[model samples]
Target: MSSNKLSAVLEKQIHHLCLKDFPCGYGTWRKTKDSTEGAETEDTDDLLDLLSCRHSPWRHDKSWSPQAPALRRLAVLTPERLHTDFIYNYFTTLRIVDKGVSVIDDGLLRFSKLEELVLSDNKITEIPAENLPSTLKILELRANRLSALNSLTNCLPPRLEYLSLGSNSLGSHDDIFHLTGRHWPQLVCLDLSDCEFKDQRALLSALSTLSCLRTLVLEGNPFTLAPSYPGFTVDSVPQLSCLDTSWISAEERQCFRGLAKNSDLIVDRASATVSVGRARGIPDPLMRVEENAPDFPVVNYGYFITYEFLSHQTVNLNFDRESKSDAANVIEDDADLQSNRNCEKESCKQLMVYTEETCHDVTHVSGHSTSKLTWSECMDFSHTHTYIVGDLGGLKRFFNKGLYLTIEEEKVLSWPAASEDVPLAKPSRPVKEKKSRKGEESPIKSGSTKDKSKDKKKKSVPELFQDAPIRRILGSVHIPLHSLVTGGQKVLVLCNVGALQTESEVEATQTLEKDLGKTIKEDKKKDKESKQGGGSSTKQKNTAASKGKVKGGQECKMDVHTDNSVSVQLEPVTVEFNVELEKWQSASEAHQLLLPQHNSLSKQPVLS
Candidate 1:
């Protein structure tokens, strides 16, 4: 309230408080003023001494009917007293309380440079935006008749930031936006503490759009009375860091987001982050490629055959004793091959090449090609991640090495043999032969074995491993089979993962050990016989030298016999891969045993 410029609306006489030439007030209504004292009235429509104009006080009240006398008086005195061009440039602020200023009439608009205007407890119904000065910033229109905010949308000063429209019926989202909208982009703080609104939803919906809002006061409003109101407000308006007097903290936001149910009155963040529309009825990758795709041409066909096929193709087909042409036709017709000449369609053959015992790279879809898979591209929808937890021994035995485990192996590995009380007995060592005092050798038995073998039935991929402590396996999840670009080329692969052992694995191991023991016994007998034979041969040679004598130029001769034998044992380890709806079949039977049976954390209502 600096008095740098005087604010006076005297009666018929001017005050002589200082020099008679002191500067005039905010509005120079009259050159002269009176010192007569008067009491204020209750009815605001009644005229007061706020202006020097001589307009009849009775004329201000439009409700007064039969206004013939008031109109007659206003026509004569207005020309001599009221003038619109007299700009009140001296005063920076003007405070007039209960002055009966029903409208933003000529008395206030004359202050073209007015910065601060407080028109409290008045009958001012509305102010047209074009009448106010742009230089005005702080506007206090509290306890006034201003109910609607529509008039103040652009009427306020362009630089006005802090506005107190409190205690007014200025409610509703439509009215609220008149102040919070683009017209008031620089408004960082707003005071609508007691303002009325349609509902909490309507209010929050309007406030959420103002991304620039930093502080808001809504304490006395009806919308702020709900349970978890602080949470709802903070979450509904992300930009609002402070509400009323309470400061919104990171911990509060984290806590209230889940606890508050009203926040989802609008699902904005979900709609913004992911496009759920794309995931609906999405086609599988394998379906896009035809099952009977023509093989791609190999430019260097002869080079491929010589290096890739001819060198590797050592197996001989035992065709029946028939014509050459017939045998050729029979070979081509055997394996459901499109054509025997088409070698490019060799992926199926290679699929069953690696067995459980022989693990290979899972990355390699072909000898020369790798699988194409990026996590983001493959996971088009929601996903659940699983962490594997089991013994290291279980995992080591689970996988052959680098290849994916076969279905049987995966089943055995997944099921725990720990269900059985008896442990698997260790293999016995072969008995060593006792050498005689004479140091004689024994004859060795020839065991039959064959190698150039045909592909046999695939053995179980999972191996029996010793029980160990829990080994946490992280990032283990079943990828939907359709997502793979290998065209549904999935195989039983061995992965060294700690997992439960099954009854099948235990039974299979017992059978294998029995077979292995018989083989070991036969090997021991062969070695013992071979040693005895060597010992007898040496003894005979010694006797021949001692009993027989030879003439002086005759060379001594002796026959030393040795038996040589070769054996090969071939094991079957190949299996057929079904290609019909392979993707759907794998997904339907995907692993679910490892998933947690109960998740209390997921059911929690708030973030800890």
Candidate 2:
């Protein structure tokens, strides 16, 4: 379309020039159509077809039209004019990425020796199989506009070993059949990641035919969300050495074997494994020990995170309303429908009352449990807890409530050091001693000493970090569960922990805010004067006011002084963790139950 052509794009991309001699009679071939008769013939050795030639002893001169050696590889950039007559048959690899090429032209046939062709990130809808070189062994059409392989699969290259069609619009279950060994028998590695394939059983059945398929990727597809995924795929195609990004372990293969046989397998609830891998970014409480308590002698501290979430049984109540009420449940028939209703409408306002009551009841009876895990600053804590969800609707509702995480910080403090340096607790004399002196005046003094020793042991037990006297709540964050249930893929979440403020810190923050407000007002006044009169003097005054405001903000950082102590400024902490939801069943039990039912044929009575 544009004046810029593929030749120009190739000139800039080529790294070096290679020259070689052309085969004899390389350009002598010419088509000869008999005019008198209807027959046509091609002349392969004739040279008289040449219109012009230099003088030579021989009638045919070979030097006049020297055949230029063909390029073995070409990578073009932004090829406005893609097709050309000059692309030769010597090419083995050709790459044209993100060039907006929408069609595969016959010009590609010129590269008879082409083995690999990369046409990723294009606007291509269908790849005409005839346009591709039969010698092509690897083809990558990732991130294209292709939706179906009906056109391409009809005549796939017999030698095609690797094919990448990821990030395309190929969503049809019928398209899965095109990937079987019937099309490309030698296809060993296939990438259909980020595609739209949804039927898990159909996909597995189709891939099972590719006995040579060693590596398969189906991530970002709807079918991958099945609890049986990867395992089901592995079971269906045991020849696969790798699935998605993970290598298939022998133990995993052995565990999930035979689960996908006959394409009728359902996952068992108790066997599903939901794993949450290790986390990063969890702040170490010991890092701030020196700042929080500098005078204390050898303080012992430990940190752990606790997460609270609702079980699947509670959320299932929203969907299985028909089981509880004969009348169709009006309050939450559909999440999308309820979301579309306006809160300002009278009908919606009336519904809210019932919704709140239902939610409250659901919350009360819900299996709310808190699990504590030790924080790992150096590595990941790859531990996970499982929750059973019976159906898709229940799974959706479960995620709507999400998970809550709280970081609890504890410290073991020495009493003598705390009494002398920190004003947390005041020393008190024992009234028991006075009572004992009066009640047991005749008792031996040795017994009193022993009682005192037992009392001291009970007062300080450093091993019990959970019930430690000095406890600090670092922060808490909420993670939505909806993401965990989607795509059946593992995901890492990172959240910043905003530390809670103490009484003294809160007071100081309020003071700083007031000072900032005054400075802001002063800056506004200076800005107004500058806007009114655009002069050098006004500009200088504005700059000086801004500088003064900056200094004021710096000075506003004051120490939080309380009645008897100064509070330490808390730092922001960040935490990272991985979460994954798995179904113990061969496939999610919820999905299996949701399958459509068909009416059975009636049987006619027959004489025995």
Candidate 2 C-alpha lDDT tens digits along 158-221:
8999999998988686688787888878999999987777667777778889979999888766
Clashing pairs in 2: 266-586, 267-585, 267-586, 267-587, 268-585, 272-584, 278-380, 278-381
TM-score of each prediction? 0.30, 0.48
Please report the candidate that would top TM-score against the real structure: 2
Compared with the true structure, what per-residue lDDT tens digits does model 1 show for residues 1-608? 22211123311111221111211221222222442235322221222221224663322322211222232233233423323232135345655555555666444456677776776666666766667778777677777777787877755578766666766777766686675456676566777765554355566667677666788887555444223244567767878778876787887676555332433332110000001111111112122223343322100100000000001111213333463224221111112123422331232133223343432212111121011111111222221111111121222122213222121210111121332434432212111111111153322211222321221122111223433322211112121222111122233322222232223233344555555556455545655565577777755653444334332112111110000000011111222211111111111121121012113223433211
**Which 10-residue span in candidate 2 carries the lowest summed lDDT?**
598-607
Q: What is the lDDT of residue 597 in candidate 2?
A: 13
lDDT of 1: 0.37
Task: List candidate 2 segments past 4 Å from native.
Answer: 1-87, 245-253, 267-498, 519-568, 571-578, 583-608
